[model samples]
Target: MAWDDKRVETWVGIMLRTGVMIAAAIVLIGGVLYLSGRGPSPRNNYRHFQGEPAQYTSLSGVVHNVNLHEPRSLIMLGLLILIATPVARVGMCIAGFLLERDRMYVVVSTAVLVILLYSLFFHK
Candidate 1:
């Protein structure tokens, strides 16, 4: 379609509508990983730096713990990050739609926002 066409803004609507849906999927999967005890350090997180590479930090203090090296868990974590990638795209889409002065995208963003909020609240 022509770039100058007014309906071009619909592309923005489509992007915003799709992005948050993907984010919802990501957090859901992340919740599953958390439930399954997938993190490398349950009580703390691993920190790599100049001083101590094996040190982990959490609510407690510095400790030593092996990270989760399980392939399945790693894959799940990757999937979770993948699921979260579209959030910025949604904002970009909203900006594009607003720049084009499109009202359709406003409605789309509203619906997407509701779904996004619902997914956040009800996610596993």
Candidate 2:
């Protein structure tokens, strides 16, 4: 089972497409919910970025809102998925490199994944 560059490229493309499609679907659902008067009401206080609550901005907050079927949280989750597409692509690249026995690329992809993770989860 030889995993060549072309095969890896195809796999990455498929992964990106799938991730984007799923994210789009989730966003669409959230939009529908919002337009149907199911989400939170609009805010007029535009003084200090009084947008969503603190729970909706953080990861655990998003998850909690999602569990409560909050439309905005679903939309946020979709955006998160969209943001994660490239990260997943990089992960697939690492897997492909490992399958092809390409140590150099595996290390490089791993570093990229680490940086992405750091920026997404750890960086302020």
Query: Considering every candidate listed, which one attains the maximal TM-score?
Result: 2
Q: lDDT scores for all predictions?
A: 0.50, 0.85
What are the per-residue Cα lDDT tens digits for candidate 2 across 1-66?
689999999989998999999999999998788667644667556788656778666766776668
Please, what are the lDDT tens digits per residue for candidate 1 over residues 8-107? Answer: 4466556656655664564465456565764455554457445432232221112122225333333343444444445445555566666667779857
Candidate no. 1 TM-score: 0.37
Which segments of candidate 2 are over 4 A away from where they belong?
A: 38-51, 67-69
Q: What is the TM-score of each candidate against the true structure?
A: 0.37, 0.85
Clash count per candidate: 1, 0
Identify the leading candidate in terms of lDDT: 2
What shift in Å separates residue 50 of candidate 1 from its native position after superposition?
42
